[model samples]
Target: MASPPPPTSSAPTGFSLRKIAIPAFGPSLLFGIGEGAILPIVPLTARDLGASVSMAALMVALISIGSLLNNIPASLITMRWGERWAIVVAGIWSGLGMSLCVLTSHLGLFATGCLMVGMSQAVYNLARQSYMTEAVPITYRARALSTLGGVMRIGMFIGPFLAAAAVHAFGLQAAYVIGIIGVLGAAVVGARIPDLPVPPHPAGQDAPATPTLVSTLRDHRRVFLTIGVGVVLVSAVRASRQAVIPLWAEHLALAPAVASLIYGLAGGIDMLVFYPAGKVMDYKGRRWVAVPSMLIMGVAMLLMPLTTGFATLLMAALAIGFGNGIGSGMIMTLGADHSPRHGRAHFLGVWRLMSDIGSSSGPALLSLLAASLSLALGIAATGLIALVAAAVLASSIPTRRTGAGGAHEK
Candidate 1:
């Protein structure tokens, strides 16, 4: 085995959100708007092109599948091209994909376009997450990351409203154009922003000695198999919430415009808790936030099928938002926590690959269950899985908390 490398240099001193995070915020916001604007409408668009609800959901699932497939490539790109360039390129790519979606009239073509957007999302997100992990001080890791997640939520809160307006003015297909605009705008912003300085490599490590992906994955196999699995299930429940809610709204015969509006409103609740959740995780422990977030989401999904009207469903959506919002950045945070500092990009790539697997499969699983049994039963089954995930996380994660109020991980 190679001798342990010398201690790495510290992150830049003093944490200022304005100094560190603000530069990246604009691109994050714009990209989130682009994605959020399109996501709620993807299933609706598929339905318009002669798809059953299950098939429509599957079309939406393609985004995650594309993301899953692209994780390693995304990581490789980030490692070689650097974060700034990768993000700018990703935005341009996503904009092109959205343009395809806007121009296409067929469901298959539209789904293909969305697949490209998903691939772009994976690259863009990996760059941003890797940047955050490298730049921010460990003590403030959760807060910084959570704030980043909150910014995305803010954009998401705004996106559905814009989508509703676009649908009203043009048509469901025209709504995709909004995403194109947002993505191009993001690319412009990202291009203008400077790349943050990453922490210096450990001494004795040559600048040219970047580690290979295969070796990194092999080194981190234990964490990847155990804690990583729980993170994937957590991601599944999160992705399911996104996929299930709008579909559930459609199932209840709510107007597409109205459904988008309610989903947007729930996102408002989601944006509200980012900082507090980060604070809890930093001080109280990961389990404090992780367990309750999963439990709340699981219970809300269980009750989702029982809702007969907009009001009851709206309550369920809000509950889900509460759960999701509190856990904003949780998966990424966990990945950062476990990743080796030396080969972080490769480890994160595999880490994200696992989560994206859950993200991709969650919708397919839900759709399959809906087809095999009933829609309600499918949702309930996800709820059960989520509860089991909560148990797995609570049992597996160490009870360590950092900073002044830090406690042992549990």
Candidate 2:
């Protein structure tokens, strides 16, 4: 397949996205909430089922494993069924998974349900991103995708609170019930999305053959190897941020309630920066946000081990949050920018795979280092990785500036 043309200044003026907002982003919010509600309880459920601490950790890891294994297949499914239907199917599948979690007491069955939900998430996320890449104009792409990210954050932020309420009212299993409701609601919302129009060919012109996954990967290997490495490290840092704050809070002997409040505040900060981050990426080019975001997170991670008090730890956690917040939607925006028109889904699958690998690996690396050495060393190493990611991004991202209507000019 031919390379994509240089970025153009032809995006239509006043191309408002208000019409497609709900259909584009609504299901994601519901899905995020459901997934978030269940995430905090998965390990607890495993322990209740008689699994050891290590085994319970493994059970939580299964979700990432499931997502990693399904990325390519999810793309194939999206290609065959289209994005809207793919989302609907994924949501239904997630609902089924949640039902299993709610009904089953067996450990193996519960693990299967977790795996299924993760697999469904892979499909649901890819389909939504693919849909938006095509539906939104390039000039507004960053804002659109960033808002989508923010929406998911909002849902996730709301989810745990809802789960807590439900757990207080009912029992532990009530969280999974909430998940079932959320996924089913997402499915209902997904069903309402209007079908995306297929781009028409010019009269009397032969249509180009659609690229397969293998061909897509082969063609995009350069970008994958370069910016892709940066993507992996970026995901690694983001994932490690989740682990570092809690571990440090524990290390400092902070109260559980205090730790939760600090983490919650960090999440709130993270949620607030998505729109501004997108604006920077769209108007100033990706590097302006990507490089500095990683740098801040990297510095925060390096400083975390030195904190002996709650106040200090809280500051570090918030720094990490602010850094990560400003990088919202960056990975998806990069994927959208580089994807070929003919096999976009296939390319995005590879992109998401790299991201998932980093997400899964980050926590594992932390566990290994913390177990073998010390927690401080592990966090410091993660900080080093984040710094490396920043350097990689600085060198790899295009230096072109985005002008009016998203035009790229060197």
Candidate 3:
């Protein structure tokens, strides 16, 4: 809850906020647009492209696989290449890969194309996170990330509706066209972002230091594991809810469009609160809100099956949004707080990998469970998992050692 300590060092290259912010903003915006365009069409696209339901699901899964590959590399690249170049290069790769999805008509080829996109996303996300962490002041790191997250959610809000409209009007091709443009827009922004100086290396070790990357990661095993487990728990629950909500909507007999729209409102609330929620995290310590927020999220999920109307769904979404918004920002700040003075990139790389794994796996696991046990039972299990994860988070706030930064120190 303390204000962030002021910037110890100046921003790299002393770029004005405008110069840096716009560049960062561009990738997020384009990602939103592309994401928006893809969401409505993903299932239909898969079927049309000749994928089985399971294979179609794999199309989504492939992206997670790519994220898995890039999680650590993204951090490594930003440490060496400078944030701007790494992000731009990653954006270009992302654009090219997503565009490839449009060109392929074969199911096998389409799946491969999707895999490329996933990989590109991995690199792009890592570059983006590392870049923000390295290029900006530490005090603003969570805020900055929060702002971008807001932008992405906004894109999500619009992307699906727009993509759906595009598909309705011009068929599936329009969605890809828009996606290509969105990615290109992201590339442009990344391209314009100027590079920051590499983190200082140990004396006389002229090559940009990566030996430390390995060692730093190895030494902080517990911190990273804790972060990883937290990320996986949250992401899986988040994904499970998203996967089942539509089915829930269908059970209540809402039209497909109506179902998506219902989910969209939650995303909208999520976007709306993100900036202020992040500022709150900045103003308050991570646990002041994060611990309680997560428990509430679990409670929200526990109540999910109790409602059958859109209004109830909306309430669930709003509560979940609030809880998650605070939780994510806090966790991110926690990652920063815990990273060794010289090992932030390494720590963050691991932290992000945990998120990718969680986000990637959560939905699939839920979907499978739902098929066997029914949606309510599956969600109930998720709710229980949420309760356990929340309890873990609430209890896991580490007591500070002597000389710890800020108030945690004795």
Count residue pairs with overlapping backbones in model 1. Answer: 7
Every model's TM-score = 0.84, 0.96, 0.85
Per-residue accuracy of model 3 over 1-410 as CA lDDT, tens digit each: 21223333323345444656677767887877875677556667789887789878778777668778777877777667766676677667766766777777787767776777777676666667666766656545656677766777677667777777877899887887787778777877788877766457678766644446668667777665664577578777766767666777887888898888877776666666766666555444455555666677788877887878888977876787777665545555666656654556666778778877777677766777788878777777777777776766656655331111223422
Please identify model 2 stretches exceeding 4 Å from their true place. Answer: 1-5, 403-409
Choose 1 or 2, whichever is better by TM-score.
Answer: 2
Task: Name every residue pair that clashes in candidate 1.
Answer: 398-409, 398-410, 399-408, 399-409, 399-410, 400-408, 400-409
lDDT of 1: 0.82
Which numbered prediction scores highest in lDDT against the true structure?
Answer: 2
Q: Note the Cα lDDT for every prediction shown.
A: 0.82, 0.88, 0.68
Worst 10 residues of 2 by lDDT: 1-10
How do these models rank on lDDT, best leading? Answer: 2, 1, 3
Model 2 lDDT at residue 371: 99
